[model samples]
Target: MLTKQDIVAVVVLYNPNKKVYDNILKYKGLVNRLILVDNSLTNNKYLFKNIDFVDYIPLYNNYGIAYALNLGIKNSTEKYILTMDQDSAISANLINSYLKFLNVNDNNGIGALTCQYNTDRNPAVAKKGYVKVRQSMQSGTLFKRSTFDKIGYFDDKLFIDVVDLEFFLRMKRSELSLVRINAAVLNHHPAETKVKKILFLKLKYGQSSEVRNYYKARNLFWVAKRYNSLDMYKGLTISWLKIILLYDDKRKYLKAFNQGIKDAKHNRLGKYYSNYEGN
Candidate 1:
C-alpha cells in the first residue's frame, strides 16, 4: 500500500477555468502533495493556502508542457511523481492501483508505469494485462524520481507534441522499463476526432490547426532523426500520411507540413509562430 507521503501529483495548467480547480480538488486527497505549474500568460499565483498540501508555481507565460513538467519533477520531494493534464480524468482507484502495481514491479526495473488511456491515437499497446511499452502519454503516469538521473528530463525543445514520446525513448535507451496496466484506466479527451471507414481501413483523424500540424510534423521528423529509431520514424510517417490525407482541411495541413519540414531543417523548436487565433 502506498501512503500519502510517497507520491506527489503534478498537474500543469494553461489558461484554466473554474472547472480546472474543481478537477484538481477531486484528486488532491489521493496523493501526498498537489503542485500546480501554471503556464498562463497572466502572472497570478494561485497557491491554495487553505490546503497546506497544495503548492502553486506560476510561470506567467506559456512555457509549454515539457517545461512545466520538468519544473514539477524538480520541485517534488516524494518517491514518485504522478503527472496529469488539466483535461485528464482517472478512475477513483488510480493511486492505490498504481501503488499496488509498483509494489511488485518497481524492483523489476520499471521506471514509468502508465495506465491504459483511451485515446484516438494509434498507439502500439498490448491488448491485455500489464504490458511493456516504449511510450505512453503523460496523464496518469507514475514515474520514479531516480529515473531522471538515468534518462534526464523531458526534452524542453519539443514544447508540446511528442514530448512524452521523446522522453520515453530516452528511458528505453537507458534500459528503463515502461509498462502500462490495462486495468488501471485513464479517460483522456485528446484532439477531437471522428472515425471514418475508407474501403477496407478504418481511419481515425481529426481537424487540426496549422500550428498543431506544424509541431507534429517537425517533432516527428526531429525526434525520429535524432533517435535513429526506424520503428518510430516509420510509424510517424504513416500516421502523418493518414492525418494529412484524411483531414477535412487538407490544403492548410499541407501548408503546415511544408512549414514543419522547413522548421525542422532550421532547428527551430520550442513554441513556433502562431497568431493565437485558434487551437
Candidate 2:
C-alpha cells in the first residue's frame, strides 16, 4: 500500500481565503510533502510559514493554473501525486482508500484515480464501485507520478479554464482511462452558481466574470479544433446562448466571447491581454 512517503500533494492558490488553510489542514498530514504553488498577485508565504512538511512556491503573478501545476509536478519525486485546488479538501480515509485501490488495481492504463466530488455544474453520483469517466476535474485527483512522462503534461497554452478537461482528453488520445473512486469523497467548493427557470426549463449559470468567459470561449474552440470534436462545438454553442440569454452583463460577455473566437481562429493564446480591459 502507498504510504505518506509515496505521495506528494500539490495545491494551487489564487488569492485564496482563510478557508484555504482549513482545507489544507485536511490532507497536509496525509502526504510526505505538500507543495503550495501560489499564483496570487502577491506572495502569501505567511500562510504556510509555520507549517512543517510544506513547501511554498510563489509566482508573484497570475501565471495561470497549468503553469503552477506543472511547476509543482516538476519539483516532486514521489510515486503518486495528489492535485488539489484552494477550495478542495480530502480526508485521511479518502487518501488511504485511494492508496489501497491503487495497490490492488491494475494501474497500467489508468491516467488518474479521482474522487467523487460534487460540482455546481455536475454533481457526482455515489455508487458501490468506481466508475470509468471520460474526463474529470483536477482537484482531489491522484495521478501516478509518471503519468505525465507517458501522456505529457498539462497544456500551458490554454491557460486557466478547461485545463483539466484538456488533460483528460489528451489522456484519452493516448488510450489512458480515468477512474472515479465513488467511495472516496472530497469537499470541493465550486464557483457560485445559481439556477433559473423559464417555462419549465431550469438553467444553471455560474458567476464567471467576463475575463473568465474569454478563456472559456477561446479554450473551448482551441480544444475542439485540436481534437476535431463536434460535441465540443455544441457545448460551446450552448454556453454562448446561456451567456447571452441569462447573464446580467450580457453585452460584456458577448464582446469577450467574440474576441475569444477571433483569437482562437488566429491561434492566439496563453493569457488574455487587451489594452481596454484589465484582468
Candidate 3:
C-alpha cells in the first residue's frame, strides 16, 4: 500500500503573482508535502514565508520551466512526485485517487498519470480513459520518482516549451506507460480570446519568433530522427496542415511553417514564441 509518505507535490513558480500562491494553498492538506521552486529575484521571499506548507527554493534568475522542474525533482524526497503548474487547481480527491492508482497498477510500467484537464470548457472529454498521448502536460500529472531515475529528468536543453512532449516520447519509445485518469480533475486558465488562441497555437507549433521557430522545428525533427515511425511522421504532417488551414494570419502562419521546415532540415530546434503578445 502506498501511504502519504510515498508522494510529494512539486510546483515551479516564476514571478508568480498572488493568484498562483492562493491556488497552491488549496491543495495544502491533500498531499504529503508541497515543494515550490521560486525563480524570481525581487526578494519576495517574505511573501511566501507565511505559507507553512510550502518549501520555497529561490533561483537567481528565470531558469525556465524545464530547468526549474528538474531542480524540484532533485529537491524532492518522496517516492512519487506530482508536478503542477503554479496556476493549476486540483479536485479534492486527486491526490488520494492517484496514490490508489499507483499502488494497484505497479506492473503497468507507468511513468506518469495525467488527470482530465479542463481549460474553460470540457477539454477533458477530448482526452478520456487511460489513453496514451505523446505528451503529458506537467500540470495535473503525477510521476513516479523512479521514472526520472530511468528516463532522466525533463530535458533542460529544451527549456520551457515541449519538454513534456520530449520526455513523454522518450518514455513511449522505452515502452513505459503514460495513463490519463479521467476521474482526477484539473482546471486551467485557457486562452479566452481568438487572438490568444492563435498565439497559443502559433507558439506551440508555429514560427512567429526565431527562438520559438528554432525549438518547434528542431524538436519535431529530433523526434522524427529518434523515433522514425510512420505514425509519428504522419502525426507531424497532419498537425502542420491543420495549423495552416485553421489560423487566420496567413503571413504569420506561412512564416512559421517555412521556419519549421528549415529548422527541421538543419536540426536547430529548442524553443519558439508566437507573434501574439498577450500572456
Candidate 4:
C-alpha cells in the first residue's frame, strides 16, 4: 500500500557503537530518507558519513530525546515518520505490515503505531492482529506527521524518561488512537538489567545509574500530576519501591526519589541541576 517514498525514518543516537550502523541498514531501504539525530556529547558523524540516503545531524551536547526527535521531525516532509533508537532494528516485512494496516484501517484516527518489541528484558509476546494501547515506547514506533500539527510536539521539559507517556496523554485527550501491531516485531537491545531472586519471585531489576533514576522519578511524578492519573502514579511508585528494595545502591536511589518528588511538587521541570551527571 504505502511506498518507501511516503516514509522517513529518524534514529536518535547517544554515543552509539559500530553495531548501530548495521541496525540502520535493516530499515534504511524501507524509507525514503533516514535522519540520524545524535545526542552524544561529542560528534559521531564520521560513522554515518559514508552511508547513503542518510542525513546525520550531530548535536555536540546531550540535548535529550524529546529535543532530538522534534529536530528530526521538523526536517522531514514524509507522510509517515518512523522514530527509532540506535539499538533498535526492524524487518522489511514489519514495515510492509504497518503500511498494510494503515491502508485497511481509518488512518486519520490513528495517531501512532508501534510493533511488539523483542527485547532481552522481556521477550515479545506472540499474538495475531492488532490492539489498542494506552501508550508505547518511542523506539520502533511509526507516527503520523499530521498528529503533531493537531496535538503539538512532545514536551521538551521532559528531556528523556516518560516523554512518551506525556505525549500519549495528550493524544488520548485529543481522541487520537495509539495501536500496536502484534505480529510485527522490532528487535530491541535493552539497557543493562539483571534477574534477581527476591523471596519467591525472580524480578528483573533495571541497572540504571543514579542520574537516570532522578529523571525517571521526576518525570513520572510530573507527568502523573499533569494528567491526574492516580493509578498510573501509584503503579510507578510501587515499581520504583520494589527496585530500590531488591537492588543495590539503595541510598542513592532513595535520595533521587525524594528529590524527584520535591521537584515535581514545586513544578520544577527540565534538566537536572545536581552534582550527578549522565542520563
Q: What's the TM-score of every candidate structure?
A: 0.88, 0.92, 0.79, 0.93
Please give the ranking of all candidate structures by lDDT, highest first, separated by commas: 2, 4, 1, 3
> lDDT of all predictions, in order shown?
0.79, 0.83, 0.70, 0.83
> How many residue pairs collide in each prediction?
0, 0, 9, 0
By summed lDDT, the worst window of 10 consecutive residues in model 4 runs over 270-279
- Model 2, 178: alpha-carbon shift in Å? 1.0
lDDT of 4 at 239: 53
Task: Flag the better candidate by TM-score, 3 or 4.
Answer: 4
- In model 2, residue pairs whose N, Cα or C atoms come closer than 3 Å (at least 3 residues apart or on different chains), thus clashing, are none
Model 3 residue 86 CA deviation (Å) reads 1.4
Instruction: Report the alpha-carbon TM-score of model 2 versus the true structure.
Output: 0.92
- Cα lDDT of model 3 by residue, 90-169, tens digit: 65667766776667776647888887776644455433345656565788788888889898998876656557777888
Highest TM-score among the candidates is held by which one? 4
Worst 10 residues of 1 by lDDT: 120-129
Write down the TM-score for model 3.
0.79
Residue-level lDDT of model 1, residues 1-279, one tens digit each, is 567579898889888776776677777678888888989987445534466777889898899999999999999889899999988874556777777777776674778888877665645332456889887888889988899877789899989888888888888888889988876777777877777788999877765566777888888888888999786677568757866567776776777776777777889888885733233
Model 3 clash pairs?
211-271, 211-272, 212-271, 212-272, 212-273, 214-269, 215-270, 215-271, 218-269
- Each prediction's RMSD to truth: 3.4, 2.1, 5.3, 2.2
In the range 1-279, model 4's lDDT, one tens digit per residue, is 677789899989999888887777776578899999999989888888878899999999888899999999999999998888888776786688788788888467889998898877778864779999987888878889999999999888988888888898899999999999987788777667788886899877557766677788888888888889774597567758755677677876777777777787887878874644422
